[model samples]
Target: MRAFDLAASAKAAAQAAVDAAAPDLVALSHRLHAHPELGFAEERACGWLGEQLTEHGFTVTAGVGELPTAFVAERGEGPLVLGICAEYDALPGIGHACGHNVIASAAVTAALALGAVADDLGVTVRVLGTPAEENGGGKVLMLERGVFAGVHAAMMVHPSPRERLDPTCLARAQLHVEYDGRAAHASACPEDGVNAADALTVAQVAIGLLRQHMTPDQRVHGITTTGGQVPNVIPEHTEADYYVRAATLAGVTDLEERVRDCFRAGAVATRSRLTLSSTSPAYSEFRHDPGLLAAYERNALVAGREFPTVTAEDDRQAGSTDMANVSLAIPSIQPLVSIDSGDVGLHQAEFAAYAARPAADRALLEGGLAMAWTCVDAALDEGLRARLLAGATAGG
Candidate 1:
């Protein structure tokens, strides 16, 4: 059969498979949402996703990239390899607040659907059980360690308040700052202590002042993890975790240096020693493949998913992700699927509550089917397939 005819048949089979497995996928989403785990600590979520894929006849490899919670499940032996990313990490205080449960479930649904038609479509389907998206850059580490090697294309759907074909994904760097000083009794020897807390205060003030000079796309945000021990004792040690984000990796690097200088200013002014370190690998800006994104948009539209017109208010929805780093190396797209959360945005408790609701379940099913259809379209399009194959890198 010709590619187009095969694509039609495969798309039908893929959609049917997803429909049949909808209950299991929805259950997976709810289960993960109920048992949220932090980055690099998603043993249960990883095992559950791997088990589902294994039961569907995929070859599952756990701990592929030196990450205990990371796994890769593959089906088919065709030349065209497509990767589906599954992020399952929850936020510190908010369980699945970022809707990663939906992301993982949708990815699993897509993998199951595509696995059913992999041979007909002449494609290898991989469901990458990626962990630590909330804190550590698990995808970044995996990409560097060759977990994504030989993949021609990558795709995933993220749940949001609204649908978007190409939402802004900024490059980001996680910064861990530390300050050291000497502790002395506040009343007896106030002059002998070099206050580390005061040093952190100066750094925060500097960052606040620097914000006035920053561009709209640049962002610096963090929380003080440790400040002091007691009210009567001068702080001897302080630490904070901050994230610096910008339009690109180079921009983030530049902004990070400046932010480091802000921390340095704090140490210098307060006579405290300063130490700066990175929490994880830096994330790159997303480079959505034109052909893949267009295919996804068409499929999603056919599935009754609408992409609302971008407004000034929508610009604030931009966030950071390690998948953006994958996009730089592979033909990829991470489209946003709306769960009808209205004004409740991602990373909030209210949104987390909506992540397991009916709307999110619908998003999971539709998003997975749409992604599977998009893969079929790409696999059948000769020109697009050739382009994706040509762009494939060793670790892509």
Candidate 2:
């Protein structure tokens, strides 16, 4: 049958296309790792990725979605539109600690592989150069700006310590909590001064005690950015940033309210002014499409990648991602591709050092091929295509 032939041809071509581009993809990952850029400032990473897409006959658009570093490269005019996300942001000090270089290169390769068969499959392939995942929420902004309005389904693989079919990500909200008070000479006019540092200290202590009653899926962590200029004078101003995460967006709201109350208690006890605000939109919890996830698992297994059995403990340790916001808008999946960083967790120097290692390079090819095959499978399957289109229509 023509359908069987197209499926077999697409599967083989996807693997072959990624294999042919393996060297350049690995080199691109290394280049991105070597020159790490912060979120929304990934000029070089965005330009390099766009260059590759342009060379591959894609119409590249930089500075899309009102974000300068955000770009999208597109090809084909068919019915199905597949959005492949490429994240290239690095952490402040740990540079590439999350292996975004691996993510960017693999996503591009996957798009290129799909481009090879787009005409035969009557599909349109797109590679979205999403610029921020670490410090800025680029994807969230793009989602708000209608950048992904017409996208049917999205897929991007994250590099991690171990492979996962689909990750369990927590919803997170960023917060800024500050206190203001009067300052005076510590010894001479202690009664005239209201110690802002004391307010923060009280808040921290309250949070420490609050841990006792924390639910299994609730998490709150913060760092004091300012305490005092010197210990001799009473501190007048103090500020802190915190991230509140929970199993769902509603849970994030509930946890944030309780956490704010702890900080408010500090301000009340010290007679200091309380200021609280959210730094960005809360990143939502992810919901993976079952059809796409199943297709990805099959492709990954055939490409010599195996996933460890997922457990609740794994969910407890899962990190939050802005891709979760994109999932809320469209059918999306962010699968984890393993790197050989034993005992070295993400956002650490050790993990950054191994991001471009041999194992990581291997992961780049496997992940790209697996994703490309997944898309191919989806295109070739009638029921799956209809389901994704129906979802897109409803999402619209």
Candidate 3:
């Protein structure tokens, strides 16, 4: 009996498959970029990715984990289940500023390519349509609901202005804070008004002051979703949403406790009712599997992707991702695939425009091939395969 050399022939096949699917993958990326959808509302993106998988002979289950946009697409019957995380949710107003369209496209291409050789490698390929990485923790919710039940190895590539392996990501939690007060005419009887706006002001000031006490890695930021209707009417109710980020989940937990004190201070100072609650489940920090990370670097290099020699201090990735939560339960890696976005930062409108450019399209193809090759490499390596097989199943 002769064993196939997955590192040699299988590599070429995977790359070829990605090349063959380049046109459709590019179209998918562009379509997602053109029609932006917010977190948990990625109907178009979800339907499109799922349809592509279904057309290519994958068994796709939509609306998994109680999320309308979440889906799981699988092929092959091998014991080793490889999970590909596809994030397609866009920012609130900036569209696909974080280039999740590229992420989704890459995941689909990787899954398709891997599916072609899954049997030979004795592996199962699963592409997960994970939504709402922008603001909500859709993956977190899905994980809690048992969506990622049988995945052995999970992998995804995020788009960024620069390429890097094992990039640092923060753990964060979202907070919804509100203040309720009595309303009165501002000009006529200002003294009688228990101003909700003032309460929010006190909270904002407290938050600013609290920042001084926090570590450099700790961050707290928010926006007033509803401040008031008019200046004449003293604000009866004020609401805001904030994000508290830290280097780790424990740090985020500690910071949230401190931050809530600031919110409570507003109510105490203004004699108003304070309502503060978590908007979504907390996102954990990224934990990269060293084996998967090395495989991806090698494959990315073969795909002509280069790591940056110099990166700006401020340009480093610091935002939270729901994919990080997947790492907690599965052996995973969520590396950044660099695109030529110039100096524009992610979550900015200009970055969203760059997400649809030719460079980003190239990233979609190359990142897919790299990830597919990595999966093949992992499946072929005896040690890596054994390790992955021994791990608990996350999604299949």
Point out where model 2 deviates above 4 Å: 392-396
The residue-by-residue lDDT of candidate 2 on 1-396, one tens digit each, is: 498899899888877878888888899999999999999899999999999888888999999989999998998877888899999999988899999999999998898888878988888998888888876688998888988877888999998887887788999999998999999999998999999999999998999898898888889998899988987799999999999999999999998998999999999999999999988778889988778898999999998788999877666677898899888778888899999787787888999988999999988888998988898887888988987777652234
- TM-score, model 1 to reference: 0.97
1-396 in candidate 3: lDDT tens per residue? 134555677778878888888899999999999999998999999999999999888999999999999999999999999999999988877889889999999999899888878888898999988888887889999899998988888999988888888888899999999899999999999888898888989988998999888987798998999999998999999999999999999999999998899888999999999988887899998888888999999999999899976556733448888888999889999888888887887888999988999999988888888999999888888888888898933232
Whole-model alpha-carbon lDDT for candidate 3? 0.89
lDDT, each prediction? 0.92, 0.89, 0.89
Total backbone clashes of model 1?
A: 0
Evaluated at residue 338, the lDDT of candidate 2 is 91
Model 1: how far is 101 from its true place, Å? 0.4
Compute each candidate's TM-score over C-alphas: 0.97, 0.96, 0.96
User: Ten-residue segment with the worst summed lDDT in candidate 2?
Assistant: 387-396
Q: Report backbone clashes per prediction.
A: 0, 0, 6
Which candidate achieves the best TM-score against the true structure? 1
Angstrom error at residue 298, model 3? 0.5
lDDT of 1 by residue, 1-396 (tens): 987688889988988898889999999999999999999999999999999999999999999899999999999988999999999999988898899999999999999989988987889999898889877899999999999999999999999999998889889999999999999999998999999999999999999999998999999999999999899999999999999999999999999999999999999999999999999899999998888999999999987799989887777668999999999888899999999999999889999999999999999999999999999998889888888888753233
Q: How close is candidate 3 to the true structure, as a TM-score?
A: 0.96
Worst 10 residues of 3 by lDDT: 1-10
